[model samples]
Target: MQQLESLIRAAENEVSRQMQVCNACRYCETFCAVFPAMTRRLEFGAADAHYLANLCHNCGACLHACQYAPPHEFAVNVPQAMARVRRETYEAFAWPQPLGALYRRNGVTLALATAGGLALFLLLAIAMKGSLFHEPLAGNFYAIFPHSMLVWMFGAAFGWAVLALAIGAVRFWRGQSPGAVGSAAAVEATKNALALTYLDGGHGDGCNEEDDRFTLARRRFHHLTFYGFMLCFASTCVATLYHYALGLQAPYALTSLPVILGTVGGIGLLIGPAGLLWLNLRRDPMHGDAAQRPMDRAFIVLLFATSLTGLALLAWRDTGAMAALLAVHLGTVMALFLTLPYGKFAHAVYRSAALLKWSIERRQPNRLRIGGD
Candidate 1:
C-alpha cells in the first residue's frame, strides 16, 4: 500500500507539473475536456489529478500537437501522464484494497478466473450429470444445473461486482466534490458519455489514436463494444422478464427477442474486440503506459470470449455437443461476472463518474488566469 501510495503521488505530481505548463499555453483546449478542466484549477492534487485523468480519452491528439512534447526539455505527455494516473486511480479507489492489485496483473488474473470458471462448471457438470458428454437436451440449459442454482451463483457474483463498483465510484466522488449538479449538467454529461464525445479529439474530426494520425477507427470500435455489451445485458434482462413475468422458459426460438438481441450483440462483440486488440497491439509505445496493456487486452479478450461462446452455444444447442458448449459458455460468463469489479471493466464506471464531474464543473466559471512566469 505504501509503495502504491508513492507511485500514485508521483503520477499526480507529474500531471500537476504538466498542467502548469499547459495552463500557460492552452494550446490544446480544443483537444479534450482535460485542458479545459485544467484551466479551472491552478494545482492538481490527488482528486484533481484523478478527475482529469479519467476525463482524458487518451486520444493522443494533445500529445502529438504539443510543441513542448518529448525531444524537448518539457517532456509534456498529457496522454501518457493521464493514462498512468487513471490506472492508479482504479487501484486507489478499488474496494477490498488488496484485490485492487489484480489490476496490475490483469491478464494473469483474467486467465486464472477464466480457468477456474471453466473448471467449476465442467466439474459441476460431471458431478451432476454423471458425464461431461451427453445426448442433446433439446436446448434445455436447466437440465445440467437448475436455474435457481445458476441464479444464486451468478447473482452473487454480479451483485458483488455492482456493490464494489458503487463503493469505488462513491470514494472517487467524495474525494473531490463537484459542488452541485444541475439538470442541464446531468443531461450534458449523459449525452457526452453515451455519445463518447471526447473520442472525437474535442472536435468532430476523429482522434489521433495510436500514431498521432487522425482516424475514427477507434471510435467506431468503441461504439461496437460498448453498445454490444449493452445489448447483451438487455438480452439477459429480457430473458429474466420472460422467465419470471411471463413464466416462459429457455430454448427460445432463433427469431425470439432474446435470441435476436444476443446474436446481434455477439456479432458486435466479435468485431469490436478484434479491432480493439489490433489497435492496442499497434499503438505507439509512448501513447500510454505499456504496463497497463494486460489489463486492457484482458478485458477485451474476456468480452470477446463471452460473446463467442454464447453464439456457439446457440448454434450447437440442438446437437449432442450442447451440454459441453453450455458449460463453456456459462464458464466464460461466470469469469466475466466474477472479475468485473477488480479488472478493466471498472474503467467504465470511473470514467463516467469523472465525466459527470467535468460536466458539473464546466458549468461553473473558470477561476484561473494564465500568465507568463
Candidate 2:
C-alpha cells in the first residue's frame, strides 16, 4: 500500500520533472500530442502526469529533436521517461492489481505460457484422435476439438480479456476525471485513433527513427497490424454466425467470405509483425525505455506466431499437418488473449482513452497560453 503509493509517486515525479524540462525547451512541442497537453499544465500533478503519459504516443521524434538528450547535463529523454511512467501507470491502475506484476516479466511468461498452452492443446488432440497429426482434417476444426469444447475454452478466455480491459480503461478514465465529451469530440478522437495521427509527428511527414531519420514505416506497419487484427476478428465473427445461424460449419471454401478475410488478415499480420520486430531490434536505445524491449518483443512474437500458425493451418487444412497446425494456432491465440490485459496491449486501451480526453480537451480553450511566439 504505502510502498505502492510511493512507487507511483516516484514515477509521477520523474514524468513531471522531464516534462518540465521539455516545456522549457519547447522545441519538440509540435512533434506530438503530448507536448501540447504538457503545455496546458503549469505544474504536473499525479493526474496530470497520468494523462500526459497516456497522451504520449512514444513516437521518439522528440528524443531525436531534443538538444538536451542524453550525455547532456539536462538528460532530457522524453520518450524513455514517459515510457517508464506509462508502464508504471498501467500497473498502478490495472484492475485486479495483483495481475499487474505480469507486466514486469511478460516476455518470459508469454513465451512459456504459449509453449505450455501449445503442449496442452497437442495433448488434448492426441487424446481425442489418438495421434498428433490426423488425416485430412480439412477446415472442420471442431471435429478434432469438439464445438462445445472450443466454445468453452475460447469463450472464457475472451470474456476475461474483455472484462479486464474494460475495468482498467474505466479506472484510468475515472482517475483522469475527464468531464462530459461531446459528439464532435468523440468523432475527432475516433478519427485520430483510427488514423494514428500522432504517429506522424503532427506533420504530413513521418516520425523520427534511428539516426534522426524520419520514416513512415512504423506508422504503416502499425496500421497493417491493427487492421489485420480487426479483419481476423471479423472473420471469426462471420464464421461463428455461419456455424450457429446459417447451418454452415468448418471447411468453408477458400473463396468464402470468412476464409478470404482471414487469409488477407493473416498476410497483413505476418508482414506487419515481421517489419515491427525488425524495427524494434534496430531502434535507437535511448529513444524509449530499454527495459521495455522484452515486453514489446513478447507481444510482437506472439502476434507473429499466431498469424504464422493460422496461415499454416489454412494452407494445410486438407492434409495431415492441419491438426497439429490447428492446435498450435489455437494455443497461440489463447496465449495472446490471456496476456492481453497484462501486456503491452493495455497501452492501446489506455492511450485510446487518453486520446478521447484530448479530443474533449481540445474543444475547450487553451488556458496555459503556451508556445510563446
**Who wins the TM-score comparison?**
1
lDDT of 2 at 170: 88
Model 1 accuracy (lDDT, Cα): 0.86
Q: On residues 1-373, what C-alpha lDDT tens digit does candidate 2 reach at each position?
A: 6776887788789889988898787887777788888777779999888888888887788887778887899888887777888888778877789888888889956665775667576768566758777677656787777888889988999999889889988888898888898999899999999998998876757777777788889989998898998899999999999999999988899999999999999999999989989898888887788878899989988888888889998888888767777777888888898888888898889889999999888777787675531
Give candidate 1 misplaced runs (Cα > 4 Å).
Answer: 116-124, 369-373
Off by over 4 Å in 2: 1-3, 124-129, 370-373
Model 1, 1-373: lDDT tens digits are 8999899989999999999999989888878888778877777788999999999998888888889999889999998999999889989999988888988977846655775668575768565757777778889888877899988988999999999999999999999888987999889989988898999987787877567578888889989999999999999999999999999999899999999999999899989998888888888888899899888888888888889989999999988777778778888888888879988888899999888998888777665544221
RMSD list, candidates in order: 2.1, 1.8
Worst 10 residues of 1 by lDDT: 364-373
lDDT of each: 0.86, 0.84
